[model samples]
Target: MTEANGTTELPKTCKAGVVVNEGPDFTVAVEDVPVPTPGPNDLLIKLNATGICYSDIHYMLNDLPMGSMSSYGVRSPGHEGAGVVVALGSNVTTWKVGDRAGIKPVYDCCFACELCWSGRESYCDAAPQIGLNFPGSYQQYVLSPARYTQRIPDGVDDFVAGPIMCSGSTIYCSLKEAGLRAGSWAVFPGAGGGVGHMGVQIAKAMGMRVVGIDGGEEKRELCMKLGCEAFVDFTKVEDVAAEVVRICDGKGAHGVFVTASSAPAYASAPGMLRISGKIMCIGIPPIGTAFAGADPLLLIGKNLTFSGTKVGSLLDTARALEFAARGQLKPIYEVFPVAKLPEAVAKLRSGKVAGRLVVDFNA
Candidate 1:
């Protein structure tokens, strides 16, 4: 019950997020919209903070699959969010007013699907993605299925917890896919960005040595500070693969998480893995893009495996938040007011952001 600017009104007809039309020219802008109501088994949340994810940019750029907007009648594009539940429907008993909740990537899934039944709901063929398919958390208030939302513990702040809903969980799930045990070496290509930074900490927490590869001296320093054993400035390194091998004692990393969607990262991965090393792809490459420079023969020769992971399931997201509450995971973020989202998105597009950019709705 933190007061917003010391006000109690809570602004019923408050400002909300809207993406005006879709396509390559889609634009996200704020508009005065009605506050939502909770439906059966749903909860209405007053968002305190939400992170600007790469997929938000990708969706805005027409680089991902956005569900039919004609059915929903609005363009609300956000998922990585942390807020307080304000209202709940009749069937929702596990949560109540003022409970902390996270609206993540996997908004809902058909429980009848085989993948959902097996606890791998993240891969459910009929999964519904918030921001892509349904209304999401960029607005002042959002309605989320109570069962799909993860609880945020008391001590974790909303601004820091928001990004975990998507970027943090995605990287955590990708690292899980790598199947590296303690003492293994894991490389993160975009080690200073939102997901990559989280990957660095998650790997380190699991007792793995991490080599962070990214651009700029500051990013290198940042990665090293975030528990990466070594930092390579890919922008300055002449041979990225050679540097990775050099850092791994002339063999190669045991696992590499490609958190950067750039072509070169994927192109250099096969050469950066040790024999039988796994490569986990977490980035959303541009639409219609393929894994460049990766050959089937090379995979067969080295006994290498490649896996692409999306964001995690509701259960996985809950585990991720629990890890954060226990101090095993953290998200580096730059907070801004909701009015400044366009500027934040602009900085994100220009690669000026040092970490995850979060919007503070209460600011």
Candidate 2:
């Protein structure tokens, strides 16, 4: 691990990753590739930590938007990234070498577009995802557009801030869009999984009462530890949705944030929403999958608003990290070495992982 002439050379080809095919047969391999070079406005980050996200598994399973999947073809998978800036392109100014920066889901965005101007670059019509379209952080080092990488605060550990870049930020944005007030009740469908766990803690930190819905004793214990006001084990409950409604005093939740990709969980959303309530869709419902829940007329009658939210902007990402820095929110994580990605992904696919999974570069 030596640096010379601004080249971080370990071997001629350092460890890197790629997606090799289609469907479950599609595999993520950790062969080596030439180290990437920084372009103008790009900063080369020597990644210390990266998170395995559900979206990565979705892409490997061929579960992305059909148009984008076909148009972009397959690429290496990764996005929740945290690292130290090792080198910067000549044109980069906002950051300097040694700055702790995060390469988020958003790699390059049309910064001049209306969405970006409004601080929603994650939703930029011309946005290109990191691990999705471009080569992402599943490598020795990653090159990121300086404009899109947010700097992590000095007090925050990179491992803790890694999930905040993507999964944590997505839930944060969804909660913001839901517009729940202090003391309002919000139900998170998959409240014990990686994203749902973070959302439960964040919702509690915002002073909202959180109802967690997930199964098993481990998840139930974790949800309770994360400050959830109620935990409904879907496996044990007679009616999961009704349990959520009961928790909200029969008025239903002020809002229900669907963090689980299960169709049945999504189908239960309308029943859990109070009158004039909102439903925020944060999880990507299963690929090639569709839902026909709650009628259109019922939406009008309940005055409910259904919305889709992407990850937050760079500013929002900074705020999310701040929550972690101040100890107001915590990202529970299971650490694994970079070489063990498949095992980590398998745990996630099996729905057994309780919190986020982080790949350790220095392990």
Candidate 3:
């Protein structure tokens, strides 16, 4: 179904991993869904791969205080997507058919907002999230605004580019905002997970020494291979913070990036930092389940600061992709076919995935 204009004919319906039940006991089942038409300013994307993130689990479980996906009638939950533009909206002149594009967490934001103008568009309250409010990447064919869609560079593959859309870019922005100088010790609390592993590589690529904290031998090996100077297994250690402090020249880490959503990880973060060191919060625990803070006396005594960041802006995502293109940031991931998407989601929910898990839509 090829046309003279090089546009491939789109199918009337396509496969999708729809959420069976929108609750804590939910399951994702593959189903046939109708392909949506692009708006005047949108591009119809045919996704090739999408990465499974823990945030997807949170959306399905409906644990976060944020509204549930079902409220907005969004059944599929995913954000990291890489694909080709199969059809272009009549008003879209910047992109053409067959161009490579990527979809991130923030689907669209109000360009008139102050946050959007200040390079923090991800925080714009008026913006709609991909998996939360809109149909997400789990669907085979998705519509993306031509202005916000990311252009995939020549050297980076779709598999690596997929996770970079969210996990990689998010951590890169966190490390950048921490403002730690090169050679400074940067510690990642969940160094073996999808976001933590990317932080390790990005931190190393920026010339910072990375010390990873996680459990199990598989994660240790993975972290070490990905450029972690030291891997601390929390399961075997009596005091995880003490080990991190001891590794950083007996002082403490310059910056501690909390990537694990567990409450204990946030509780022990301050104990792993030196005087004037900072804690950059990236993982979001369920509301009222955990809090990250230190005593006012300890904060004043040590001159410590705490900060947090969400997904990166368009500029940050571009810089992260540049790092990948230059062979600096390499994403460690396992690929699964579309039929095994449910299994992949279950594995991610269990918290045993050493690296990212990607689902290939065309496989």
Candidate 4:
């Protein structure tokens, strides 16, 4: 295949990080697996790096109540992928064999759906997640739909390209949904987390005065280094909500971006909203739970808007990549070998990781 393609030879078996004893006892182990063949309109990507997201932990542990990876016949879990295309299907034309591409949260959507037509394909009801519904980027080789796979720009390296596949781009969409103008105070509840940190940088880039909410000195330093105008350490504050209210001229901030999954973060979010302010819900709670700011009366009284957004569309992802290429949005991640995926996932599950964790398939 290398002689035919003038590049990497196709290997019958490739190394992959496979999940074992999924659900609370989940573990990832590197093993040799059969390389997949690309279907029509698909591209076989030899992934150089993949980003580890907390959602991968939920899928591995069955933390979300709805569905399990086993139920979908999925063993490897990952969505953030950055690599080069080694093979293409018969019908592919838009991409070359060696083009750089990245995987995203949503793998493919039904193009015929109303949501897909309306430019909201991320929320398409029939959308299949890359890692959850299919074999994801945990392996050295993975397949992505040719049209859906994002093209990585020339200037962005794999380390930065991988996280933008999901976190950076998703938060970019959320900051746009926030609709806050320049100089408005916008607070990120989990500013030290991957998505929250992305929000902080993009929000600041958008000319908004940013405040970051997190737990300790490490996170505070990280937030401050990311250009957050103010940092609120929730552990030391008597009342984080009151502190935010105090910081924003006693009327609360103009916007609050909730990127933490903690119940307390959701509970105290409304208290940080000013009159007519917005709270962009970017986190997911455990199954069967509701956000604490779901009170109709509070929204009515404050005339506030509460909205939820999922990941970004393909166009949004491309634009977000431009942001990274231009150095406007930067990613902070700790890279590890694919063999250390279980450890990375454990660290992320422990909630102690300050930023994103990425795995190099060849490291």
Candidate 5:
């Protein structure tokens, strides 16, 4: 129960989607877990929605060479979480109970690190990941460090804000690193998936012309609706690279943003770019199974640049939220009840999801 003054009657136990097995063959089960208390500099947040990301699948499969979530004794796997703060830590005076908050991929990083000071805190070695090294938002009641929490604006819905915490901000960071200005040609491979769709919107909002590459009519419609100037259906096109080059005025895209983990996406990216074009790598393919590179001659001749980025810093997330609040970025997502989290995870694993899939705890 919540009082008018924002005081909450804390619950002893809350519903959570706990991982049944922590390996390749794993499942999510709904269970009652003990509610976590806020630390001296933390806040107790009651999550309304959490977006499912492919990174969660990697953590559960124990792949990616990043170690297993079990190493940290974490069961629930989720990072994009939007909710309301129900309690504040004793030492936290910046946030109040009932304030809207969201948790990002990086739970906390050492503030004194060089990377943290240089606007690259997401790569800080001392950072603990939200779902990997800490109990994540799959638990209804979770604790968040007040310093790293994102303040959700009043107009943005939870479903839209949740995915922005990760997918939206991640692609936004990659786009910023690409350094493409307005009217530049931005190509998005796998442009209809969770992260890719958000990239389409953000790039379009930034005044860049977007070309989306994916298979099927559904994704084509989505990309077109989201402001893609051109779309290539790989399933129907005999040569995806040729199609992308043709669409980009016969020169090729200014930047290729690879948001799909498929190896083919990486292999075909360089060919779809013009001279001096850049490749912004966002998706993680299976460890050691894939790589993105071009021959020395091609790299030197074309002067192409390859850059990779992890999640975004707090500033990047704030800017992403501003886009959402200003009606420029709207994330497309499907909602699932907490009990059907397993079904949602399976759908995402199938690689057919058009946009993001979010699980609602209060549903």
Candidate 6:
């Protein structure tokens, strides 16, 4: 059992990636910082790894329409993290030392809201995101709320669990919202990307036939290895949507899960869905950019539904973790040590990475 601030024999400082510019030209600097103490409802976690989400890139660039990370008083930017509990706060009991755990995009949500009560806490209007509001998992240690923290299961490795906390879980919720059954054709616009790759695996595990659309041969190979039934190389295909429609038996896919930020992905999504099909969105396009094809006439004519999810509820994370454990949602990430986080960030920003990039803090 841990006692208040002295919870465990912990070091005063730990290595972390600090955002220097805090804006579009931001860069990360590896520095030593004081380890944060857990509050009454929090747990101090010693993170082993964190996933480099595209959202992290957005936070560092201040690209979101919302206020800057500086406005939120956050410097380090990250969300998907997996580690073990090191200490517990005065009121924390749901977790203990050595218990594997993970953090998600949402650090904490107003649990009293109707959304939270209905198990949709990820959409809480006042929720403070991990990398934005609180110090993110880019550090060696982070504070996680007892209620918001995820319990990483024994079978799921930390490397896989990290991304599962955010990207994996986000797509998992999208799959659920899609309500796709076995043998249904599901189209993933960016099937080789982080969220899309996980979505491919999850959709497959759910028995859905997947048609993955992306650019380049590398992405196509990754999608196929991850169990996508059909891989569509958008860069080579004359008409990606038309090809997807053909792959789905001439009408359209049962659903189109858009996990790519490209405007064309959203614009062409409506054409890839079957009658009564839904578009489950998890990607964030550039600020001020709207889904151009959201014409009510088209939606009404096709009986298509448009719904989206941000991160995901804790339950959603749990389900995704299970999928990873079952070898259904395997990660296709390039692992980098914490010291190389800046390089990982740069590579992701440059669009050179075919899948997710994970940072290992212990290194």
User: What lDDT does each candidate get?
Assistant: 0.82, 0.82, 0.92, 0.88, 0.91, 0.87
Alpha carbon lDDT of residue 92, candidate 1?
80
Identify the superior model by lDDT, candidate 1 or candidate 4: 4
Q: Is candidate 1 or candidate 3 better by TM-score?
A: 3
Better of 1 and 5 by TM-score: 5
Cα lDDT for residue 180, model 2? 94
What would the TM-score be for candidate 1 when compared with the true structure? 0.93
Off-target runs (Cα >4 Å) in candidate 3 are: 1-7
Sort all candidates by lDDT, best to worst.
3, 5, 4, 6, 2, 1
Global local distance difference test of model 4: 0.88
Q: What lDDT tens digits, residue by residue, belong to model 1 across residues 313-355?
A: 7666766777788888878888889888777777887776666
Q: What lDDT does candidate 5 reach at residue 52? A: 95
Clashing pairs in 1: none
Candidate 2 whole-model C-alpha lDDT, 0 to 1: 0.82
lDDT (Cα, tens digit) per residue for candidate 6, span 1-363: 383355347889998887898776888888999999888888989999999899988888888876777887778889998998888888877776788989899988898999999889988897888888889988888999898889998889999999999999899888988788899999999898999999999998999999999999899899998898999898888888899999899999998999999888888999888899988888887786757357788889989888877777989899999988887888889999888888888889887778799998877
> Of the candidates shown, which would achieve the greatest lDDT relative to the real structure?
3
Off by over 4 Å in 6: 1-8, 290-292
For model 2, residues 1-363, the per-residue Cα lDDT tens digits are 223345645345556667777467776677777767778888878889888888877877776663333346535678888888877788887887788889888887888988888988887878888876777777768788888787889888888888899988888888888889999998998999889999999999999999999989999999999999999999999888788888898889998988888888888888888899988888886665757357988898889888888889888888888889889878999998878876787787788889888989888
Q: CA lDDT of 175 in candidate 1?
A: 76
Candidate 3 lDDT over 1-363, as tens digits, reads: 121156546689998999988887899999899998998899989999999899999899999888999999999989999999888887888998889999999999889989999999999988789988989999989989998999999999899999999999999999989999999999999999999999999999999999999999999999999999999999999999999999999999999999999999999999999999999999978778878999999899999999999999998998989999999888889998998899999999899899899999989
Q: Model 1, residue 115: displacement in angstroms?
A: 1.1
In the order shown, the candidates' Cα RMSDs to the true structure are: 3.0, 2.3, 1.5, 1.6, 1.7, 1.8
Clashes of each: 0, 0, 0, 0, 0, 0
